[model samples]
Structures are given as structure tokens and as C-alpha cells.
Target: MQTRMIDKQWSEKYPGVGKGPVATEPCISPEYFERERELIFRRHWLNVGRVDEIPTAGKYFVRELEVCKVSVLVVRGNDDQVRAFHNVCPHRGNTLVLNERGTCPGRFGCGFHSWAFTPEGKLAFVPDEENFFDLDKSQYGLSAINCEVWEGFIFINLAPMPKQSLREFLGGVATQLDNSPFSEMKLLKTYKVEENANWKTGLDAQNELYHLPFQHRYTIGDSFLLKDGKYCRFSNVNLYNYHSVWSCEYNPAHKPLPTEALLNRMDSALTNIRFDKRISDFDWYLIFPNMALLLFTGPSGDFFMTYNFWPLSVDRCLWEMRYHFPPAENVGQRLAQEWTIGQLRDTLMEDAFQHEKIQKGLASRACSHMVMQDEEITIRHFHEVLECEMAKV
Candidate 1:
């Protein structure tokens, strides 16, 4: 089959820099979805699960690559190492694990042929051993895949040998995470939303702040400043990858905390804390290809939150928002943090619901392409990176 090349006129007009309206068809086309499964998800360093999920030995989690029709069993081995394996039996191809997450009893046995394997992918036992006279149990171990953990997040590359290691794939983004508070935080709460939009569409909506005023009017626009929100900006208007880092400062001049609200939430230490008058900001790190880490800091301490967008189908995505907070000893502090999380949850729901409607509108035949302006540079860069990656394959 002849691959349709990107038009020469389009390339010439954009010249040196590829800037053009991305066609809406890519979001709804089945062929593009197949290409993404092979070129993007299968070849890239995709986030599988968090290390906290498999903190102890024998702890395991199952992650499904629905597009590729594969399931992976990620386990923390007795040797204090993490490993991932094709969650299938060697005897017949039945999945070894059915549950989403659990603690394996040091060994996994397939129900079909009773083929047993150790946590480290070593074949341990086989029922009716004598019946298989020439069969070698040692050679029939569970198939293993490439897996690594970075900053407490487990990443899996489905390719037999990934072109780049996870660290190399992340590049400078990993350094930014080191300075953030993710390593020292505790899980607060997680909210999962299933949206009827392509993963890129949902991610594009979150990557830029341009739509905050119009789309997030009541939820965040009331408190967020349109022009002065961002700080510590990093922009890479490249073809294959793009990233941006910025900070949003909370408004101090708006109004002092109400007496009752302060008394209910503030601790003695927090009340006495002196904040840098100019530094009441939250830092946002968007690593292109697919991940977002948000760090919020004040004089007291900090918290980290992660947003992972997983593509389920061409027009369906599973968005996970996980929050991490500083460890709290007092009950009041914990409750106050939970209240803050509740406010964020409500705000995010408003944002995600609006994106679903946007997806429906994009699917309409009336809209052929998306128009991006200068203020939406992040969204433009995202489309450029995606098109470049797709072109390579």
C-alpha cells in the first residue's frame, strides 16, 4: 500500500517550521488509531503503574494494552526488583492473572494446564510432569518484557528492544521531577474520568491556559489571572517533541482569608508561616509525548499532582488524576487537605466535561480542522510533534 505523503505545498508554505491546522479526521479515523497503536503506544515509554501500587514483595498489578490486545503483569520480586511479564500462560495462551491488582502467593499457576511460574518469570512447576516426557519446564518460563521505574512511576516499553532507555527518552524532564516534591509526598486521593474524546484532544485542552477564561469561567477564571498566571516558562517549538514549564501564582491581593475559614483550616505552624510575598505559585511541568506533573508550593511545604492520559479508543480516553500531599500527623491538617482536594475535583470535572462536548463537535462534518492561534502555542506544538512522529512511521 502506498502511504500518502504530506503535501509539498503544505510543507513549503509552513517552510522550516511545520505549522498547519491539524485535520479533525485523525481523531476519528480507524486507520490512524491502528498506526498509533504500533508507532506510538507500542514503541514509546508508556506509564504502566505506580511503584506505590507494588511496594511490597509479591505485590502485583495488571495493566491492559487494549489496543494491542496484551496484558502485562507487573510484580515486585522477592529480590527487591520490579519486573513485568506478558500475562499469558506458556502452555496455552490464557491470561495468567485475572484480577486488576493483588498480592501473588510467590507463584503464579495457570488454570488451564496448571503451569506454574515464580514471581521473577522462572518456570517452577508443571502438573503431570511425567506426561510431558521431553518437555523442559525450565525453558517454558513466562515471557518477560522491558520494564523500569523512574521517580516512583513504572514505565513499560512493549518493543523487544526500545531505541532509547526510559531515562534517555525523558531527557531533561527527569531533572525537573527531581527538584519537585513527588518523592516526599503521600497519596491523597485519585479521580478517574472516562471521556468521549481522543487522548490528544483531552491533553491539548489541559496543556494550554488560553481557554481558561472562556471555558472555565466560573470554576477557575474567577480566581486565575489570564496574563500573570504562568512563570518559569520553557518552550521548545520542535517537530518531534515539545515541552513547557510554567508557574501560576495565587492572588494575595484579592482578599484576606475569612476569619471562620482561617480558623477552621489553618494550623498554628501554618498561620505563623511567612510566605515569600512574590512566591505563592504553582509550577506546571508538561512533558510531551504524554504526562503532566503539577507542583504547588507555599512557605509551609508543597504537594505534587500527576495527570496521565491513556487512550482507550480513537474517541475514548481514560484520564487519571492523582494527588500527593505532604505527610500530616494531625487529624485537622488531613481533613483540611481533603477539603482542598474536593475543590480541585469539582474544578477538574468541569474542565473534563467541557472537553467531551468539544469532542462531539469536532466529530461533526461541519468542522474540518482546528484553528490554533499564537496564544495556544502549546496546542500547536502538540499537533506538530504528533504529525512528525506519525510521519516517521
Candidate 2:
């Protein structure tokens, strides 16, 4: 159960990360969660989906963000521009765009009162035009939110104006992963789980590898084969503006499971597209607030995954992990991709099953603050960034 000696001096390595006990109140208090909703979730750039989801004009999707307490309808205008608006009917405040996603043929209609609208948020038709006076068709339309895109990912901000652009928010993480073949891969599998735990608590677990060798012992522990079948050591940690990145060293001599063997054979066949990252390293990026971009090896060099943690309340959050891969041309490649999905699902269940217990423990007030190890520097850095953003609220 020993890990190879990596740099244990996290404070010394990243002196700015600071040494402090992360208070338990932030994780279990409704008031603090409210502040987070106002400051972080509302103002910060949030990645809702990919551009490919709405490739054609008039294609739209509704994202129900419980944290922000608003349903956002993201649509592609006739000009091929993407935008977001509050998914509410202007006349009666009825929920607009009930379906999760679809193409509206450049127009949308409110089923509640038969109010029609364009993809550009313009009123196209009204059921009772003569009934209501001063019903300016131009004025009564879906209120728009600040929307932007970065590297094909659609992002939205509920704030009247976001403090920083998506590029600024991404900063170093973007530079590090700029060469990453994210666009070459498409979503292959998606796992969504709602758990009874503070969003921060679940995020803390994901932001570090401290628990991987232990908590995922049976599911992924054997796969890692770290020294005595335990311990995960990060090669390096880099903190960027409002974000962080870590590198995981893949042990070349490590033993692979049966499925991995098949994955390897299929992977070796696709030698045309070789990325250094896919060979033996995992570059994990933690975007501020609640996005994790992890690029690692799959059956091919074009594989990656994203973990999005959306807060619903002080004691609950929705966790989603999406696996992305290049289009498979052979059955072996397809099976390998499916095997990876199954493995991730099993591993996440082990993680989800413990969230409620953590929330309950924090709520009990058994401890005022929790300790952080050098190996878990990212968790500490995450709290520091969160506190800074919350201060602005």
C-alpha cells in the first residue's frame, strides 16, 4: 500500500496555495450555499453543452439548472449564432420549451397559450392579439442571458455581465489543453447521478487522487497497480488563474485487466493518430466552479472525459461524467469503448454511495475544520479559489 515517492512538499512546491483548515460550515450551511449560488453559479461561465449538440440552425436545448433556479433555452439563430434566454413565456410566465432538446424549424411556440416565438427570441405570433393592449411584439420576448463559446463548448452566465470572458476564466487550463484533441472526440457514454451531498464535498473528492487508491480499491485500485497495489502520485501540480492542472504518470509496467488487454490491441491498430498524452499520461484540468476536463488514454489517442458538478442545494447535487472518443470503425474498438463506460459507472457508484455520509458528518458539527494533506493540494486550492469568488458576492 505504498506509493512511489513523489514531491511531498506541496506547500513548498506551490507556496501560494497556502496552509489552512477548510471550515466545515462552507460545506453544510444553507446561507453559504446561497452565496455560492449568487456569486459563483450565477456569474461564472458555465459549460452547458457542446456546439455539436446544436449543429444546425434552429436546433435548441433546454438546460434546467436548479442551482441558478432558471431553465435556459439555448438555441441556434438563423444566422448560425448560439444564444441563451430564460425559458419562460412573456405573457403568463409559463415554462417555455418543455422538451429537453429539439429543432424548432427556426421558430418556437408556447403550448401553454399558443404564443409563438422565433429562435432569435422574437415574438412570431400571438393567439389573442387584439385582447391585450400595448402588447409590443418587439418588447415581449424571452429575456436573454450572456452567452459565449470556447473551443466548441457553449457557456452561459446568468449575471447581467460576467466579470471575465470564457477565455479569461479558462486561462492556463486552456493553454495546457489547447493542443488536446477534444474536438476530434465525441461523447460516447454519459453517466448522471444525483447524490445527497454538498456540491463542494463531492467536488473535493473528485479534485484529488488521495482517495483513488483506497475508496476505489476494488473497482479501479487493481488497475492502477501503484507500488503495493495502493497510492496514486501526481507527477506535478500547476495552479492557473481560477483553475488548476495535474499530471498523472502512467506506470508502464502496471498490469492491465482483461478488458484493457482488448483495448490495447484495438488501440495499437490506430497508430495514425498519436498524441503524446495518450501514450502514458493523464492531464487533468479542474475548471473553476465545477468542471473537470480529464484527458487520458483509451483504445485510441483521441479519448477524453468531462465531469460536471451542478449544485441543486446545500445538501444535494447532480454529478455527470461524459466519456468521449473518436468514432469507432471496428468491433474491437467499440467493445473497448463500452468496457470503459462500464468501468467508469462502477467506479462512480462507489464514490456516490459515500456522499450522503460525508454531508451528514459535516452537518453533525463533529469537527470545525478538516485537515488537508500535501498530496491533496488541489482540494485546498479549490477551496481558496471558491472563497475568493464567494467574497465578491
List lDDT for all candidates, in order.
Answer: 0.70, 0.81
* Each candidate: RMSD: 7.4, 2.6
Clashing pairs counted in every model: 1, 0
* lDDT of model 2 at position 190: 80
lDDT (10s digit) by residue, model 2, range 1-393:
223465566678788887778889999999999888888898889989888789889999998999988999999999899999999998899998989999986568888888989999989899879898878899988889999987777889888978778888788776655565566677788889899998888888877777887888777765542544467777677888788877676665666788678677765445334454432466677888888888776546557788889999999999989888877867777787788778878888988887778888989999999998787888889889889988874
Error of 1 at 140 (Å): 1.9
Please identify model 2 stretches exceeding 4 Å from their true place.
1-4, 225-229, 268-280
For lDDT, the strongest prediction is: 2
Residue 311 lDDT, candidate 1, scale 0-100:
83
Model 1: residues with Cα > 4 Å off, grouped in runs:
1-19, 228-242, 254-280
**Ten contiguous residues minimizing lDDT sum, candidate 1:** 231-240
